[model samples]
Target: MTEPTQDSFPVTPTNKIRVAKRANYDRDTLFAILDEGLIAQVGFVLDDKPIVLPMAYGRIDDQIYIHGAKAARMLKKLKEGLPVCLNVTLVDGLVLGRAAFHHTMNFRSANIHGTARLVEDEKEKYDALVAITDHLAPGRWDETRETTKKEINATTVIAVTIEQAASKIRGGMPIDDEEDYDLDFWAGVVPISTSFGPAIDDARLKAGIPVADSIRKLTSRR
Candidate 1:
């Protein structure tokens, strides 16, 4: 397979910087971090004012898809073809050091900059919504309320080309100065983790309708 194209997001020299060597520019690592993240904060400029909104997103082939109710004012500007940026980040751990100034958090983060385009085609809109649902909780859309023609028309979906992006990662314990390490103090990493639990059945569901295998699998193994 051909290597996916990538562009370095122009980070202003004045922007905050930590461990520069841990910054990753490869497309594969960036995409993997994006895929694991559950929420993306989309940023856009409208009328000289900047706005940021957190929303769910899904990756499709070579594009990133996101949407909101068509009537929502937040998405109105986006649907108007405004340029937008999407960012997803996951904090992996808390790196503590003997020196207070050296405390830091390990993380994996991705930021994508691109012009947003509306999904005007009906079939494409359907597929985009499906991708959004499936990306969050796989196989759940099939069991939930399907989007109606009116609902579909009332929602706005935007697809942005996957370009001008990169992922930055920082992990492991604190990298303290030699003098700081010698100071007597406790220092180590506090790991961060995510887990799913038992499925809660709806009180209204018929007793005979057993939990679907899809959900059963999610809750079966911690």
Candidate 2:
């Protein structure tokens, strides 16, 4: 597939970054970051207080989905079609510099601004749940039991279109002053890695049931 250029999205004031060179508006970049992110911090206001809630999220095309109990305050407030800000960040490394002032971190972050609407249709909600599950576990959706009517009715899902989004990325070694470089200090980057641990069977698991191949593959890919 052809990659969309960074100029595809408009450079609005809310989505613009002070360091323009570090900002990316490419559709591909935004989608990549969103798909890789397991959690998102959703920002919104309720009762005159601004709050940020970390939630599990899924991305399909240009849409992001987050689900929770129907009675959840955050989900109820968000379904009212209020403006929201969603943020996802992936820390790549710890950038250490010779000087304290020059210390920094290497990371990639994406911020999205838009309004979320409730997803009520049965098929769409089911698909959204599948997407969410697959985001957490690549192929576990099909292995689990199907969603029942009672369960479906108890849950609420919100869909947010990628109307305005931007990604900021930083990498490479630390930047230090020339004079500081000559001082007796160390400077380098400590890379960060992510991995899934081995699966532990449930205490009540049925006898002789082996770990699913999908789970093994998922953990192995890390």
Candidate 3:
């Protein structure tokens, strides 16, 4: 995710929230969070009406690529050039608390707000689809066959430039109020983790793909 990038999308022009500033932005840092997960919550407004929808995404260069069935209401609405905010967040841990008021979760999140555009170029769309596949499973892009003409025709892809985005991170133990901190109780982080499970081959997996080594070596659980 850290390949050097121009990050042509400037952080200053796009941020609306001051709490979530872009000073901490480093392409490698932000996009790694985007790359580690496939789901994103996209926010948009149509005709003065607001919308936020969660969908799958892939990152290529400085753009966030997302797709949904053409019939998806969010997709249909977003295709109208509405301004959108895309949120990608990963919960890293649950903070155990001495008081309910102190309960919190350690997380990494990025919120991007900007106008989204429907990708009309066939070549760019093809590349974006491959990036989506690669984002889900690294080697699958090369291993899986390309999208069929009909499949491409039916899918809708949207791209959001990596403009002003704020990355907010919360980690470590809960900090209870001064009075509550003295309460005798467990107050530490309950670590949460994400991992890829063993690849499950289809019963009909054809002859010799034999699960590539890249796909086989996964999972923290035995």
Q: Write the per-residue lDDT of candidate 3 for residues 131-186, one digit (tens) a residue.
A: 88777677667876666998988899999876566666787878788888777888
RMSD of 2: 2.9
Task: Give a tens-digit lDDT track for model 1, residues 1-222.
Answer: 124344333344322245578766666777888878889999998889889989999888658899888778877778646788888999989999888888999999987777798888889989999889877767767877767999888889999876566677888989888988777899999999876767777989887988876677766753
User: Model 1: clashing residue pairs?
Assistant: none
Best by TM-score: 2
Best by lDDT: 2
Worst 10-residue lDDT window, candidate 1: 7-16
TM per candidate: 0.86, 0.93, 0.82
lDDT of 1: 0.79
Runs in model 3 lying further than 4 Å from the true structure: 1-23, 207-209, 217-222
Q: Which has the better lDDT: candidate 2, or candidate 3?
A: 2
Off by over 4 Å in 1: 1-19, 220-222
Compute the lDDT for candidate 3: 0.75
Clashing pairs in model 2? none
